[model samples]
Target: MIREEVKIISKEYLNKDVLKIRFEKPKEFQYKPGQFINIKFEQEGSFRMRAYSILNTPSEETLDICLKIIPNGLASESFKEAKENDKYTIIGPFGYFQLNENEKEHVFISTGTGVVPFINIIKEFVKKDYKMTLIAGYKKQENIICHEELKKIEQENKNFVYKPTITREEWGGLKGRVQKHLPENLSKKMFYICGLKEFVIETKESLLEKGVNEKYIKVERYN
Candidate 1:
């Protein structure tokens, strides 16, 4: 896909190595909440592309992406150096991870940068007053991104619930993977999960064991 120049509007740190960057896209840009965009940057001798989920509401003029920096990672390194007003090529709002608008109850399960897409979807759900639950798993409380924002959502909407889990830290929130928090009864709700390969697989198994219909579950896996 050909890339279009998108102007950076703002950037902020979410955690130790994660960044939330907002950019300005064309007014006509329209994409589903869980869709992703392909970003390209030149390093060494070539331009490499990486996929990142869109982290803002579709109705908004600004586009956002939650990026996690990894050692020797091309896209994250280049993005870390990007400043406001800088422009770069963005290829798409792709992928099929999206909410079923007709479904009244929904569960969003995520870990690390996998939480980005859920953030976008939850924002829309809040605007529309949809019933939802967010289960985020991290290594520690400090590793949970968007902590304050999610807490506010939970407070403002009685239908919304946020649960943060830590696998390696002793914290006040739920300790363990999101799989530990799946409702005892899952016959009536929809489920969405995004995360590392193993995490996704394990969560899927747990949900199946709890009686969540296979067709009602959606997942996006990242290595």
Candidate 2:
């Protein structure tokens, strides 16, 4: 629980609604991959704090986060006006969503910006001798975030495979929800899931029904 005000070094939109913001890393800040930090800001003239998952490995030079701007949400409204050099208080590198070391193969499943933590986790273990697969779901191609960067990582890393599924739109690749497109070797790999309640609950139930041990499946629910 260290809290410090940090300067935003850069901020840009990865897509129409996703904001990629980078902060000058505080010398005292320490965190593991897949963790999130709370940003303290003003909402309705009062102070409000919200948790955002880190998108880059902690070892990286800067602390980066991708914000999915929900329309009219308190935190979303504050971030919409955010600019470079803005300073905001950040607290903790919280959550226990780090990579599972016991499994040689790891599967990351998510919808929308739920993929944020996986981005950080993957960056940390990308160099290790482990197989990683990402199943990311979105409403349409236009809604896909970090699509090209994940693809490039897949192309360059023999251990990684990126699968993007689109629902409510025409797509030549995987379609429908993430639960429908899970891998075959379910019992062997560690599964990580993040998303809204319905998606996370359904995906967890689906995995349990498929004989994956409940202990091997970890989930973080968000909206």
Candidate 3:
């Protein structure tokens, strides 16, 4: 890991609670698509930090982080008020939640803001011949994030499929949690899951019960 102070290039709200921040990439800094960075700042004379997954592919010139704001959250509150040119110390290129380059058939499951890393992975690695299925879960239609971009990817790449489901509100698309929308067959496919702890646990268990080898499943959990 390396420590560097970077300037925020811009900030925008992607949804009601999700903020997308772009930072100036430091010279000589490099990171894989699915990694994350820890942003550190000072509050009340004490240092505070939070880790957010990198949302931009390595081919992008800048670094992007998608943050889900929470009520009274220290880091979230601070980031909500952050402005362009603001400088913060970041340390990382952390986490092993990356893609297997050789895998042709891949399945990704994410809930809410947990979809960040998958966005990076797909944009960076998905190719014309690669078959990828993305199953995203949200509480309501308004809670869905990055749907437009995912849809564009699906439209442009015939091999890619996007499935978004809502749990609390009715929609024309599928309803219920992502686990319920998972594909029935798991053979010869790799699965990547990210979401709340319970969602990850339940999905992993369901996959295991369906005879998916643990080796073919990769998971990252959020609180």
Residue range 8-99, candidate 3, lDDT tens digits: 99998988999999999887778987888889987667999888999998878898999899988888888988999999999998999998
Candidate scoring better on lDDT of 2 and 3: 2
Each prediction's number of clashing residue pairs: 0, 0, 0
TM-scores of the candidates are: 0.94, 0.97, 0.96
Q: Order of all candidates by lDDT, from best down to worst? A: 2, 3, 1
Off by over 4 Å in 1: none
Question: Pairing residues by index, what is the TM-score of model 3?
Answer: 0.96
Residue-pair clashes, model 3: 0
lDDT of each: 0.86, 0.90, 0.89
Task: Give a tens-digit lDDT track for model 1, residues 45-100.
Answer: 89888889988888888888888888778887788888999888888868899998
What would the TM-score be for candidate 2 when compared with the true structure? 0.97
At residue 165, candidate 1 shows an lDDT of 89
Residue pairs in steric clash, candidate 2? Answer: none
How large an RMSD does model 2 have?
1.0
- Candidate 3: which stretches are off by over 4 Å? none
The parts of candidate 2 lying over 4 Å away from their true place are none
